[model samples]
Structure formats: C-alpha cells, structure tokens
Target chain A: MGASLLVLMIPILYRIIMGPTGFDRILGVNVIGTKTAVILVIIGTLFDRVDMFVDFAIAYALLNFVGAIVVSRYFNRTVPLQEMEKPKPRRRAKV
Target chain B: MKRTAFILVLLIGLLLAWAARDFPAWGDPHSPASSSAVSSHFIANTGVDTEVPNMVTAVLADYRGFDTMFETVVVFIAGLAVFSILRGGPNRRTRDREFVVDFEPDLIVTNTVRLIVPVIQIFALYVLAHGHVSPGGGFQGGVAMGASFILIALSWDLKTALARFPIERCFTVAALGIVIYAGIGLLSMFLGGEFLDYAHLAKVFPVSPEMARYHAMLGVEIGVGFTVTAIMFALYAGLSTDGRMRDGL
Candidate 1:
C-alpha cells in the first residue's frame, strides 16, 4: 500500500519538477506532502504499530501545512509568478 | 563547471552506494552492532535498570545523558549564533528585497491555524511526556511546539508571534532549559552519585531507584523540550526577519 502511494507520487513529483508557475509547484509539493503523511500511516499499519506511526503522520502533516503556508506567505503578491519565466540580462561581476 | 560538478556528485554517490553494499542486512542478529555486548546489555537490561519501555529514550535521557545535554547546548549555540549575527546591525530594510510580503493576514488561514495550534501544542506535550513508553521525546515535542508558534507568525505576522514569545525571553527560556538539565545532574551529584546519575535521585524522591531514573528522564526531557522549543522559534524569527524583528516571511 505504501509502495502504491509512492508510485502515485511520481506524477506529483513530475508536476513539481516541470511546473510552469510557482503556484503549480507549491501545490504539487503540498500534494506530495499530504500523500507522505498517508504513506507514513500505511507504513505504521504494516509495522503493526499504528499508535507510534500515527504520531509521526500527524507531525509530518503539521510540518507540511506550515511549509505550504510559509511559501505562500513569502510569495504574497501575484507579480512574481508573471515575471518568473522572463530571462534577465546577465550582469558581469566586478573584480 | 556544472558538468564537472555533476560528475563529481555522481562519483560520490557511486562510492556511497558501493560502501552501503557492505552493510549488514537489516536487523541481522549476527551484525556487528547487534552482536556487541553494549547493545545486548541495553536491550536486555534497560527495563530492569530504568523501568523505561522505550530503550531509545532510556538510553538517550539516562545511560548516555551527558551526551544529550551537550546536544541541547549545541542547539542553543546554533540559535545564539544566528541571533547574534543577524541582530541589530544597520537595518537592511532600506535595501530592496526580492519579495515583499504584505501585512494583511488572511481570515481563513488565521482562523484555521487558531483552531489547529492548541491541538498541536497538546500533542507536543503528549509526545514529550510519553517518550518513556513510546518513540517521542523532547526534541520532537519541542519542534512541534515551535512549529505552532511559527504557524501563528505565518498566518498573522511576526509581530503577533513576537508579542506572544518575545525575543529576549526566548534566550532566557533557552538558557533556563540548559539550567534545568544541568541542575538535575548536579542534584544527582550532590545526592552522592556522579553527574547525570539519575538513580541517586531515589534518595530524595521517595521512589525506587528505577522509578527515580524513570521520573528523572521525564524531567530531563522536559528541560530539553524547553530549550528546543525556545531555540527553534528564535532561529525562525531571526532568520525570517534577518533579525530585524519586524516584517517577516
């Protein structure tokens, strides 16, 4: 079951890697994070230690939520997404 | 340059994989680590010695406690270094930043976080207090607690979080944590045991020596929780605001 969830994350991983917009990447990462919590729980069930693993899953979920919020907060405006794909002229380093 | 770096990384990765092939199979009884007298002693006697069902916590907070105390100090030092480096230089806010976060807090996010923070904190305490019987301990609990504060900061603003846990007080709490850990150690020493010898606590605590060790482990864990919780939040505050303690990410 955990293996299946990991296999499913491949698409989300690709979305994260090839995402056009920053928001797309963020959403992809969030999806993967949520899936990871589920996977943790599945792993716990396999180990026959649901009680132990559930704590880990909860902590992982909380951290995942906090991470997504931090990223969204950092990119508080919509300007960066529009400008992200544009290439800037390279500046020479001053010696 | 990029190609060279990639090749270098590949070589290192291949070397690491080659090294990993020599490692013993998972949980192999004949593995060097499992066969060692030290590990066998811990496995067989941890319950008898400390009454702790979780050997990892017992080993961490009791048998090898001196090391854990120093680990907490290392965390404290890392926070201190970050705080000192970024704090109170000329304000860098005058310089243009790549991203400027808006001051407005979202109602939905804030409300949701308000609902969630208490649960997270209670769980943190559970993890801290329940370390002896399960997998959690001070470090995990402290991180959870710190994350709750960080969530508040994120949903609202840095100022709101700072208002709840001020910067100066962060250091104080951090130092106090170290003091609590060391104080217990010293008390044990004064009670006729070596430093961090929690068994000696049985003399004053009116419990069996094993139970004394168990309770002392909880005390030590609480101390570690305090330092970690404070330092984690402090590091976040310092790094996020570049130590200005003003507008933060």
Candidate 2:
C-alpha cells in the first residue's frame, strides 16, 4: 500500500517541479498532501498503531484542505489586471 | 548569480544528506530519546500518575502544564500582534485609487461547503474530546474547527463567515480560552497546591487526585482549542484583507 502511494506521488512531484502554471503546481501540491495523509495511515497500519496515527492522518488531511483553500483564495483575489482602470464609454454632445 | 545560488543550494543539500548517515537507523530502540532513562520513567509512570491513556497528552498538558499554558499565551499574543499591525483601516494614501474585488461565490462550491461544514465541525470536536485515547488534541482539533469557518468564507464571502463569527466575538472567545486555562491553575494554587498542579484540583472538586488531573487536562485541552480556533480565524481575517476587513479576499 505504501509503495503504491509513493508511486502515485511521482507524477504529483513532477507537476510540482515543472508545471507551467501556478494553479497546476498548487493542484499538484494538494494531491501530494492528500497522498501523504493516506501514506501516514498506511504506515500506522503497518506498525499496528492505527489508533494513535489516525489522528495525525486526520489533522494532515484537514490542514491540506486549508492550505489549498488559502492558496486558491489568495490567487483568486489578486489577479494582476483586476485593479486596472476600465475604459470609459464615449458620449455624443447634444446638438 | 543564479548559478552561484544553485551551486550553493546543491552543496547544502548534499552536505545535509551526507550528515543523515550518522543519525540512528529507523525505529532504532537504542536511539537517544527511546533509550533515555527519563522516557523509561515517563513510560512506566504516566498511566499511574495521570490515568490518561495517551502518554503525549499526559506529558504535554500535565507534566509540562506551565509550558503548554505559555504556549497558549504565545498563540494569543501572536493573534494580538497581527491585529495590532493589520487591524488599522485601509490606508488613506490609496483611498482615492479605490481597491475593488471581483469575487463571485460559486454555486457548486457554496453547496459543497454547506454539506461539509457541519461534519468538519463535529469531527473537530471529536478530535478535541478524544485526545485522551488517540493522537488528536487541542491544536489539531482547533485548526479543523477554524478550517470549517474558513471554508464558509471561501464558499461565500468574508462578510458571510464574519456574520456568523464576528470580530468582537473572536477577541472575546480568544480571551475567554486563556482565562479558562489560567483560572484552573490559579484555582488549584489557591486550594493549597502549586501552580498548574492538577492533582490537587481534587481539593476543590469531589474526585480522586488522579481523576482530577485527568479531567483538568481535558479542560485545558478545551481551552487551548478555543484560543487556537479564534486565532486561526483572526489570522485569516487580518491577512485576507489589509486588515480593513470591509471587503476581504
């Protein structure tokens, strides 16, 4: 299980390393974060300490979601062209 | 310049990787921490001393109770520090330029948030309460709780989340959490015990000293949870805006 999870992270790591867009990189990071939580649980199962390690998994998952949300919100809020002045409409003078 | 930085980073990374070899092997029973007498003593006695099954919690909230209390205060102070820096309204210099937000809360996202917020909050509480038996505790639980509110903000707007949990309420809740943690310690001290001495809390409450410590730890965890929850949201509030908070990110 852990081996498969590590395999899954390879592509995520690739995207994180060389994704063209910021959003793609963020998505890749989020995927890796999710996989890490699952891996943590898998490790717990292997060690026969699931009860103790499950909490760590839950916390990791929750924090991953929060990180993703924060990044998306921050990026969404600050598009470079957002504050640019809108062009005014042309008007005709009364004859 | 870039090449130099790259080479420097590579050197540092390789040096650190080389240093990793001298570290103990994975799960080495003879590792410094695992083999230490202090750990052996804690392992043998925590259950008897606090009656708390989770050794980490027993040590963190009880044995190092003062440390944890100050840690809570640190979190509170951090929140206040952010407030002090960012709580000022929008700067007058940019008042005429007029910052505008182009956010539109998505329908699908809002529905998903509505579905998930309650479950997240319940799970957070479970984590907080179940810390005695499992690995979950105040910090994790509090962050989860705060995440639910953050999700609400994401799905809707900041105003929507803020309406449910106001700025004033945030400050009040944060202060209340600290008061609860310290009040317990003071109460115990007044009852002829040392500061943060939970076992002697039995002097006031009708329970065995061990049981009193156990229950007191739970109360401490709750207090920590409260402060963390408030601070998490407070940070979001301050950072998401320029602390103007009228129209948050």
TM-score of 2: 0.88
CAPRI quality level assigned to candidate 1 from its DockQ score: acceptable
Cα lDDT of model 2 by residue, B13-62, tens digit:
99999999999999899999899999999999999998999999999999
Per-residue accuracy of model 1 over A1-95 as CA lDDT, tens digit each: 78988998888889989887778888987888788889889988888999889988888876787988888877762233345568768967544
Q: Tens digit of lDDT per residue, candidate 2, span A1-95?
A: 79987997888889888887677888888788888888888999989999778877866765576677667777666443444566547766534
lDDT of 2 at A66: 64
lDDT of 1 by residue, B133-224 (tens): 98999999999999999999889888899999998999999999999999999999999999999999999989999999999999999999
In order, what DockQ does each candidate have?
0.28, 0.29
State every prediction's TM-score relative to the real structure. Answer: 0.90, 0.88
Q: Alpha carbon lDDT of residue B186, candidate 2?
A: 92
| Pairs that collide, model 2 | none
lDDT of 2 at B123: 87
Error of 1 at B24 (Å): 1.4
Q: Cα deviation of A17 in candidate 2 (Å)? A: 2.7
